[model samples]
Target chain A: MSVDQFLQYLISGITQGSIYALVALGFTIIYAVTRVINFAQGEFVMLGGMLSFLLISSFGIPLIPSLILAVLFTAIIGAIIYLLAIRTAKKASVVSLIIITIGVSIFIRGFTREFLGVDSVRPPFFTGDESLTIFGALIRPQALWIIGTTIVVTIILHLFLSRTMMGNALKASAISTRAAAMVGIDSRVMALTAFVIAAVIGSIGGAVMAPLVLTSYNVGVMLGLKGFVSASIGGFKSPIISVIGGITIGVIESLAVGINWGPFTSSYKDAIAIVALLIILLIRSGRLALEERAD
Target chain B: MFGFVKNKWIYFLVGALLAVMVLIPFDWFMGKYNTLLIFIGLNTMVTVGLCLLMGYTGQVSLGQAAYYGIGAYISAILSKTYGVNPWLAMLIAAIVTGAFAYGIGYLIFRLKGNYLAMATLGLGLIIWILFRQLSEITGGPDGMGGIPYLSIGGFGFYTTFKRYYLVWFFCLALLLISQNIVRSRTGRALRAIHGSEDAAESIGINVAQFKVKIFALSAVFASIAGSLFVHHLRFVSPQPFGFLASVKLVVMAVIGGLASIWGAIFGAATTNILSDELLLGFGELDTIVYGLILMLVMIFMPQGLFVKLKEIIVQWRSKTTQKV
Candidate 1:
């Protein structure tokens, strides 16, 4: 591909990568605190986008307030999910937990389809839809908005974790739930906080990217999978690394489609992340096995 | 007579079960539900394998539908396009799916728990994508049809009655074989690994090899079911082999009491009845119900519905005898 085309793909990749980064961040926080992968993490994103649209169009609320309400509502749902489903399961095996989260995902998808309908919807862009020339490549203003929001969120999350007593308690619980509890930190509360934080980040991503990518009930399946891939890229440990992983995945995918050589067409675009997931999993299986054994 | 019955009641129960199995599909019997029974049989074949993997071996596979799709597509393509005997095509599908599972199992068995689930899930999605994208070979989303029925000599499994018997035959055989496996030395090793992988490894169980072998065996069962499904329906489609179908299979395995081989039959039958019969009018509400069933069952009785019910029955029986 030419330099301009490369730059164009790069810009678009970064924009999409920011969304994946937000989703990965969500996964990381939840996995860290609760040791559950939270397969329904992507549904929070879907909820954000779909709820924002409902608030704006059905309730006749303005865009900014609708987005905020959507995020808050999604956060509440996340808390309920933890209390109702995840926490209720006493001494659940890993297999049981996985199936439960999958059930949550399926339930959310079906609920949305029944109530909101299956058709894809896109909220109006934050600014203008017009593309601006940057280094001989075109970039949409919305793309910039997404990337800027990601940076701000990351910085604030970093500060929250480092500076706040609640955040430190969350971090301590992630390190060792038993130890955290011994230190008088409520591990259950930490898990709830983790879910809420994950929801906030996922919803922010969903609301921000809704205009760029159409929002729908079933969109969570793919987005969740991709976010999982991104988080797995960082061993689902560090938020910073997962953010970088998300961007790398986005760039590779964009370039794959942009090049359009052989089986790299858009038809096989979804396969790219999954294939990456398998490859990375195979490569890291030994280390991951050790980690599991350590646990 | 009562003393004789107590000594030989097991045989009597087995004889009665065999009779019921044989008589159920007759015209005067429950022939109207023959189609549903056949589907339950097909699903039981797959779920039994899943039971062996999850219940016995303590491994989770969320990509069984990939094997199912592979078996169906291979049988469909070979029998229809190449004019191969349907029986031979089915055998080939089983072998190929077995090898594919072996290869994937070798790579993925290293990861434990949730990561393994994710890897298998990714594999299923990739295979589903292939089924959709390779339109020329697999007929893509429109699906391929006109596959021939399985035949022996001149007789063919063309009618629903014939298909039901054929499917149940395969299903029962697999269930029996699975039961034997559970009773054998290999079953002990699998249970040992499930109980504690490290302890199993220390006991010279060769954990990885056993896991890979069981995973391949499960995949083979799923493939055989797929072959049967394609021939029975005379069609192959990518839609049925997606991620949701894989989840459905796990749901069946869980509901049937993952550790109990016979429970596979009940799991498959109950799920099919719920979805295909009772929930037909509810549309998307069925999905919500499925989700609820999975969550509630896992939370309350991870040992599974069938196993818990059996436990409760046994407890009640003991209580009644003591009162007597």
Candidate 2:
């Protein structure tokens, strides 16, 4: 392939990758704090997108305010979910928590269908009708927004987690709940904060990506599953690693579709992210076992 | 006296109820729609297997529908292409699905919790995709048709009423087997593992073996149900065995009460029938309604409807004794 084609694909990959990264960050934050993988995290993204579409298209709200409203609404919803469904199952087993989260996800998905209707909704792009041509490849203005937003969000998150006391307390709780509690950090509040942050980021992802891929009630399942896969590929260790994993998977997937491996190409594209995740996990576990044996 | 009446008479009443169910086809009032109950019976078979895995073994499989699809496709292809009898095709499907489950269980059951769930979810998605994409062989999205109806003693059971009895027979047989397994020593091992895997391992239980075995057993049941479903419907599609179907099965098992055999049947019937009714009348909102039910059940009735019923019964009995 030409360098220009490859660059175009890379740019497209990075745009999709930014969305995945945001969702993955949401998953990681929730997992880090609560030690519970919120299965409904993807639904928050769907809600954001659908709500943005409704606010912008239906209500004629400005794009920026609609996006902000979508993010805020999703954050509140995440906190409400934790308070209502997850709190009761706090002492329950991880299996129960997983089931409850799945239930919550389904409930949200169902509620979205009821609220938004079954049709895919698209919001007007914030960047307007502008396309930039570089090396004979056209790039949408919103693609730049996605990439720019991802970097800005990452920096803000780093600052929030490091420079702020509540952020440090959240990190401390993630590390050791007992120790954090001893230090007078309320782990419950920290968890809620993580949920709020994650939801906001996830909503931002949904709002940005909604124009690229139309927003529907069922979109969360696929996005959430992919985000989870990205987190897993990064070993769920660091947010930076999670973003890298998301971008890597996204680029590879885009390339697979671009290359067009005959009839199997479309099928292979869907399977690629999952296959990469499986291989990474297998290799990681193998290395862990070897290290254990050496020890 | 109440305990004796409840325990002893309930069994007889259940038997009579089942017998009446079986005899419904002979009566003139039964119609073609009564055959839907056979599908319910097949669902019960699969759900019972799922209940054992999820409830007793404490392992969640989102790939039960994969096994079901495998059985359906295998049996359908075998009977259609090779001209194998439906009965023999079903048997082969069960064995193939069981063996496939064994291989997958070894690889996947190694991971616990959400990891296992995700892995199995991937597996199910792969199968569903394969069924859709391999259009040349599996007929793609249009699905395969002309599947032969099951036969016994020179009688072709193709009608809905006839298939109802056939499916009901298999359901009862499977239920009996499931109940027996649940009451056996192996059941105890599974429960122990479910309660706490680390504790079960400490007590000398072969945790891996029990898990793989139950998983395989569940696959067998699901495969058999799939085979029967294909035979009855005479058409097989990927949509019915997709990831959503697997999720629906899990939801049924949970809503009906996991680990209870009768609860599995009740759950399958209730959720399936309710969904069908809601969807037929209410359009897309049915999914939302179903989701609401699932969330409400998990939040308020984590132990499930069966457990709740048992609690109420116990309370009623105590109240009656106080009056006495």
| Maximum-lDDT candidate | 1
lDDT of 1 by residue, A1-295 (tens): 8999999999998998888899999999999999998989889999999999888878889999999999999999999989999999847989899989999988888898889888899888989799999999989888999999999999999999989999899899989999999989998899999999999999999999998888999889788888999999899899899999999888888889998988898899889988888888888888998887777
Per-prediction backbone clash count: 0, 0
- C-alpha local distance difference test of each model: 0.91, 0.83
- Stretches of candidate 2 exceeding 4 Å from the true structure: A262-264, A285-295, B1-7, B26-33
Against the hidden reference, what TM-scores do the models get? 0.97, 0.94
Q: Candidate 2 overall Cα lDDT vs. reference?
A: 0.83
Query: Tens digits of per-residue lDDT for model 1 on B173-280?
Result: 999999999999999999999999989999899999999999999999999999999999998889889988998898899899889999999999998998899988
Question: Clashing residue pairs, candidate 1?
Answer: none
